[model samples]
Target: MTARDNRLHAFRPDLADARLEGEVSAERFVAGRPARVAAPVADVRRAPRPDAGLNTQLLCGDDVLVFDEAEGFAWLQAERDGYVGYVSAADLAPRAADPTHVVTAPRSFVYPGPDMKLPRVRALSLGSRVTVTGEAETRGTRYGLLPSGEAMVLQHLAPIGTVAEDFVSVAERLIDTPYLWGGSSAFGIDCSGLVQLSMHMAGRDVLRDSDMQAGALGTPLDPGPDHSALRRGDLVFWKGHVAIMTDAANMIHANGHTMTVAREGLREAIARIGYLYGGPTGFRRP
Candidate 1:
């Protein structure tokens, strides 16, 4: 076997890091088979608090790769994106998606049956991998893919590859989801809350609040006016507000006015605001 095969066949290391300070939430390991995050009120340490109740709040496909049930924290090295924080053992689930899952955009959904009329059961998130179980009638609107080798109809794109794409995919779902200060649930989310939630869903551990988030991302790219080269997922900082860059020219944020997640033109929004901290200190992948 080659190096890749050797790595996969090599003896497994301990993943004590993946364990958190709580009870097992879901099912446990079945030996030879991969492990699953225990379901219940398990504490996901060093993890971004998604909504509160805290039982493995946000789940991510990325978590599986670095998930070392035998270690303290699973370290996932991104091929493109950088590194993220750790996730407790209870938050992750089995990699049900087969390598064959497909999507239309970064984030998408799948139906239980080929018939659109059939009630859709499970909703697959971004970066989910699965097999093409069966083909559905080309409705020209909905798509289909197999999840974990199981047949299913899909409507939208099943995001695959790259941590950056996965983060962006999860971010889009919050669009128009509504904004709330200190809110972290699907019901409501604030600016930093948006970033924190999005990152958390993508398997990163980032804190809430603009200042804290600013410190967490990295150094500010610029120190003064000149917010021109802002990339997608970049943090747009202000006096009391912060937003996630949806694109180079647009951003999505939860503000007091909109009180929900909404899109804004980057330059237009920046120009409209009086104070602009164009200088981004740094960039944080997680």
Candidate 2:
């Protein structure tokens, strides 16, 4: 395997040759069963405890393959990106039989009934999938029925296959969202999370980390001395960070430096990131 394939395979053991046998081997994991995130947001941890380091997160309706359960945690693999970690067993449920819609808005609320006056059940973030059981209109507002019997505003959802016209525009909508390590939700997100979420909304599948994204995703741009050659929608990569150019002169990214999704001058970002995290390794266009 090439270095890039090696990196992808390392995190996604299920993609490796089934003949390879080991503790992480997928072939020996026939007992694994499918599940779905039952909560609005579920934290996947490095270990099975609240204090354990967070490895990633799953939004409501995200699919997971449960391998084992111990105490109150389930050791599972996130179906979207093949991420493996432990999540609260209570945060998962049997996969919905017919998920037809996905959350398109940055965030949306689920209520106990069709009435807006009903108590809120929970908040779901963008990309959350849901099985619509029925539809109702209350006070002129349309609501979709969830598998759990709750109701959510239909305006916040789109058919499962809907895709945005521009990935950059989707990212731009997340400006000012707080930065969170290993976060992929609108509530908190990281550099690659911003890219991955935006790309996913645009009907593109992308890896979950900066280095993985740098190795995959798009065609490399011709080498340039600075940001002078970059254009709108170009992906710029540094040693451990990534950003999306909004225009020839400006770029948007979620960076620890700013601790939020922010837009800055591309030339100035190149200079600042170069001094701080070393210059960008390269650029690519999708």
Candidate 3:
């Protein structure tokens, strides 16, 4: 684990994933068990303690490989993006069959039955994978039935292979979402979380952090100081922040300044954030 990123690798001083036995040093290794996120949102923490710093988040139905379960936390690696962290043990469940659809709405409610008047079960965020075992209808509204005996509006779900023509449009739908440090859902989100969620809906899964995204994700562009080269869908980056260009003149991001996902004039944003985080570190077109 010397050169491998701990955020994406399973390792600690006393233990490591069995898959890394020959490539990394550890006192012992174990091939972890498979599981899926049971909570609507599970905070992935840097350490096992309840107050440990949050590194990322996993949505309901997200798959994980659990390496250890102790202290009421599961040390695991997310299957979709390789993010490794500790999630509360209560938020995990035995692995389910493969999902067939993704939640397309920013947030969609799960109902006890196909009827809209019934009490709600919970809400699933956009990009959450769901296994649609069957379909039901009530009063002209279509619903996708899940294995848990819950129903989600079919209008809010897209078949697994569905893709968006414009990923920026996906981000636009989340305008004014409250900014959260490591939130993973539409209820709240961060700079990189916004990018990853929007891109996932567009069928382009990306890394979890601004730095990781800046280093990967797209073709690098030499946008000059004024950023005259930027256009729609281009990603602009600061040291620890990232934003998607809505157009040449505007961009959207979840920033602490506004504490919400908001659009800003490109020039104003550059100047305001530059005073703190310095100027844009890179530009990318995906």
Candidate 4:
């Protein structure tokens, strides 16, 4: 049998998703159970341990297929991008949540009630999905209510099918966000995570990692030696890194160099990144 990417396939030595029964070897196979993320943000880890590496994050209302629940963790696959990993069981509920709206602001506050002065229930990250059961008016501020009885500022949400005019602007909206390895929200984000989140806001869904992105994202572009051919919304890639061009000469990225999402000169980036990771591997335009 051919080796498969477990991040996209659900299988393990002891058990596997029954859907892959004939294709992979495992001691047992069971169908994945439906679930939804109930937490504001869920860390999907490479292993079940809290200290294990985080492979990705899931926003509230994201649907998942849970294969196993053990030791306070649940092994599952994100339905959005098919990335598989372990999420804390506490962050998930057994029902598949249906979403009517998505958080459009960099972050949104879930309130105990419809009032802005009410104590905050939680801070939901951008891309967090919610079902707007109804609307409420509190002190002239409008709010969207959820089935669980929480409320979010109605202005911070957009209807489920709403699309952004520009994905690049969506990326720009997250400038100065903290850089985190596997984070996907406005609270913190990585390079590819930024790309994935911004693109999703524009109604385009891409794969999660840099290499996976480079392999399948967009058409190739020429950097013109001086790297002037790059334009806004174009993606430049290195061995394990990626960035978004904001203009012919400038680009914005969530980088370890600055520890925050910041803009940098393209020439400066090419030279700085060349020292440690070498020059740009390729460029693409979506």
* lDDT leader: 4
Give a tens-digit lDDT track for model 3, residues 50-121: 999988999988999999999799999999999999999999999868889989999999998888899998
lDDT of each: 0.49, 0.83, 0.91, 0.91
Cα lDDT tens digits for candidate 4, 1-286: 1247888899999999999999999999999899999999999999999999988899888899999999999999999998899999999986744799999999999998898898897899989889989999988899999987889999999999898989889999999999999989899999999999999999998889888888889999997877777789999999999999999999999999999989999889989999999989999998
- Candidate 1 ranges beyond 4 A from true positions: 1-56, 60-99, 102-109, 126-131, 138-155, 162-174, 180-213, 216-219, 223-234, 238-241, 245-251, 264-286
Ranking of all candidate structures by their lDDT, best first = 4, 3, 2, 1
How close is every model to the real structure, measured as TM-score? 0.48, 0.89, 0.96, 0.97
* lDDT tens per residue, model 1, 1-286: 2222211221223321223212223333222324333221123333334343321123233323443344444323212122223445455555554344333333343455555555665554433345564555655544454543323445453444324446666777778776655555455566776676567546575654566666557556642345566677777777667777776678778777666678888667766665444433344333
lDDT of 2: 0.83
Model 3 clash pairs?
none
Predicted candidate 2 versus true structure: per-residue lDDT over 165-265, tens digit per residue = 99999999999999998889988998999999999999997878888778777899964664577788999889988999998778999998889999998
Which scores higher on lDDT, 1 or 2? 2
Q: How far does residue 188 in candidate 4 sit from its true spot (Å)?
A: 0.9
What's the distance in Å from true for residue 261, model 2?
A: 1.0
Could you tally the backbone clashes for each prediction? 46, 0, 0, 0
Winner of 1 and 4 under lDDT: 4
TM-score computed on alpha carbons, candidate 3: 0.96
Error of 4 at 223 (Å): 2.4
